[model samples]
Target chain A: MNTALCMLAAANPVGHVTDKPINGQWYVSNVTVMLVLSGIATLWLLIPAAKRITTGKSGSIDDLRTRGVLANMVESVCLYLRDEVFRPVLGDETDRYVPVLWSFFWFILISNLLGLVPILDITAALGLNDFHGTPVGIGGTATQSIWVTGTLAVIAFVFINGTAIIKDPIGFLKHLTAGAPVFMWPIMVPVELIGMIVKPVALALRLFANMTGGHIIVATLLGFVVSLSTALGGVSGHGLAIVPLIGTIVIYFLEIMVAFIQAYIFTFLTCLFLGQLVVHAHDDHEHDESHGGEHAAAH
Target chain B: MQAMRFHLALVYTALLAGPAAAAEGANPFVGTIYQAIAAAVVFVTVMVVLKKAAWGKILQGLQDRENRIKHDLDQAEASAKQAEKTLAEYQKLLANAQEEARSMMESCRADAKKVSAELKDQAQTEIDQARQRATEEIQWAKENAVNEVHAQAAELATNVAGKILRRQINAQDQQQFVNEALAELGKGLN
Candidate 1:
């Protein structure tokens, strides 16, 4: 039980890196490796698709046809994210922000999926889990780490506030003041300011918690199998171990779903937040008024 | 001042609450600044590379494809409109030709009827004239034949009288006899 708990602990952000120091204050971490791998994986899938799309003859029938299956699939996902998800919210500004959003989504999704693969176990079975007491295997999910998710949230925070300020500085300040009556300014201003910080913090915590929680559940359930086997003697213990093993498998599948859901949620919320900042309060109000008036007239 | 105090209070509360607990031997909230920096660097690098290498190109391609499709559809619509116009013109022309043919047939029928009526009238007049002329000639011929018959009878009577008397007849007596014989023949013929 303790060993299983230690293994689960190893999945967390602080301890997931190798203890072996490469330099004075620098140490190579499993998450760093995963981050690098995810980046490379993203490039591998997208670069070819991009080349196929750009370099092909523009008006030919073959050019209009979807490139290979992989390229087509990638294009479809990108188009859906841009047209359906981001464009409706961001409007004409979708083009300006889509590159960053696309990178963030694919990077995070790949990182989460990497954690689902048992690369560390495979390396361990091959007797290559560690190199001279330094862990050198591919395992940890970078998004499960608070630091990784926190960085992403911070980047989102920068874009959200920066865009708001850049678009209309005075409006942004007024936004922080919450558009309240003069008497309620004292109360509303601080609340809105705190909300700014809280939004990204919540974003970071949500992703980290979701990814870590699913992993912990799977680890704990698997630990039960070993516990049950050890608790009972020999043959009966081995027979009873099958129960938790089945439970662990079920949770593992659930983790996979959670992985995709978390990635989508993170990207979706980020787009929504960015959209809020990009379009001003006055603009939103006008849009609402017009839309409401039209609806009433239609009715 | 009130807003500042509220801000401070919120921060204090957040710090006190801290973060959720982690599994044994791990602190969930405790992340190294180094790792955060590393992650930031990685994210920025990925964003930059992908923006330059893939996203821009992909978007351009999609835009191009949209423009091409729109162009093709516009051309198709234009040609369809042209085809529809041409069909309408052809239908109109065909209708005109059919009307002309119908009118021409009516005129031809009228001409044929007029020619047939004129021919019948001319033929009737000729036949009437021929019949009148033929009757006139026949009457003339009958008169001549009657006169010839009277003359021959008169000569024969004169000849018989002379023969009985065994003497030649005089000129004045012969003429008076012929006149009387011709007048009797004319009455008989009428």
Candidate 2:
């Protein structure tokens, strides 16, 4: 099958049109659908949430029934960050950074799911096969695309450090040279700069590598069927074909879980970084002192 | 804090490699998508408006609930005070009823004693009148018996005088004596 036909075939699980590929580079595949769906879903969720936060009525009757789902889901995510994730690490400074973290979580999650579709699995599926024969959206995992993950990382990088600088300009700069004495400044400065840039970059790669590696492994495993077919001249390949098919089924479920997890990890790390910058070092010191005091009194 | 920072550095080091490799691609920086840029603008605008509105309304709701609780508490206290007053009044009424019953019993005993004394006096007076009438009847019977005895004595004395004249004189003298004697006896008896 041609690149366009393969993509169209993969994009629609049902075989719609068997012939006539679309002209030029304009194309929609499974990955594209996943991307569009995610974007729509995210917006659909955020609009009512924005309204509720502004109006503060729990909402009107229609709003309660219709827009309530997305609003409720966003609120739950926000609440989780505030109560469980942010408060534990960042302490009282949690509130200031929660919105940004919430945004990051949802944006990354939707995109990761977009990467998991089979239309994006082409290059990986055929084992480094020619791109000319593959469909547009059929081969590129969205999250695996360095551009996509890198963009997300960059946003996190700017927000976390930016908020920190705004909150405590001196402290934000000083955190770079924080570990040792005045003599260590020259060495620490370079390290801190690198550290600053590395935070988001690492965030991007973690997501990218995980998605890419999983896709490649599944594709390579599926290619075994073709190899066996060739080796046994067709008969033995058919006998062993069911094995790879069963394996593909199991991998599919694992990929779904990984998609959600990778999204969480991306969001989680971003929040942790923000927490480090925004929360005061003195508060943590006080907490330690109080804890020590209790321990001493107990003794 | 140092440990946390160190951990973050480790995490970032691992991730930086992915983006660096992707930087070698045909178009490393694709700028931003139109949808993403739009979403970011919407996010900033909505967040500012929502922050102000949410904080204000939530605080107001808390205040309203507080006022309602205070009003309910005041009403309960007033009702308790009124109930206490009613209880005190009932106790006073019960005490007054007991005192009146005691006084009425005392007066009833006094009036009963006075009535008993008047009845005894009236019965005594009637007994005295009955005894005087019985004594007067007995005295009249005794005086009538003495008058009957005096008339019998006068008749006996006249009889003795007639007998003495008969024995001493003749028949003719006797007859004349009898006549004179009868006249004298009758005049003496009368």
Tens-digit lDDT track of model 2 for A31-84: 233445555655555654655533324444332231356555655565565668
lDDT of 1 at B167: 85
Predicted complexes: DockQ each: 0.18, 0.02
Q: Alpha-carbon error at B168 in model 2, in Å?
A: 63
| Number of the top-ranking candidate, with lDDT as the measure | 1
Tell the DockQ for candidate 1: 0.18
lDDT string for model 1 (A1-299, tens) is: 46534433433333332222222233466566667777788788888888777536544577666668887887888888888988877888888988888888888888888888866556645655344554344556778888889999999899889988988888788876655788998997898788778778877888888887776666555555545554453666577668768988998889888887777767777777777667663464754553344234223
RMSD of 1: 11.1
Model 2 misplaced regions, further than 4 Å: A1-37, A48-75, A119-140, A226-235, A282-299, B1-190
List where candidate 1 sits over 4 angstroms from the true fold.
A1-27, A56-67, A128-138, A177-191, A220-258, A280-282, A285-299, B1-23, B26-30, B98-190
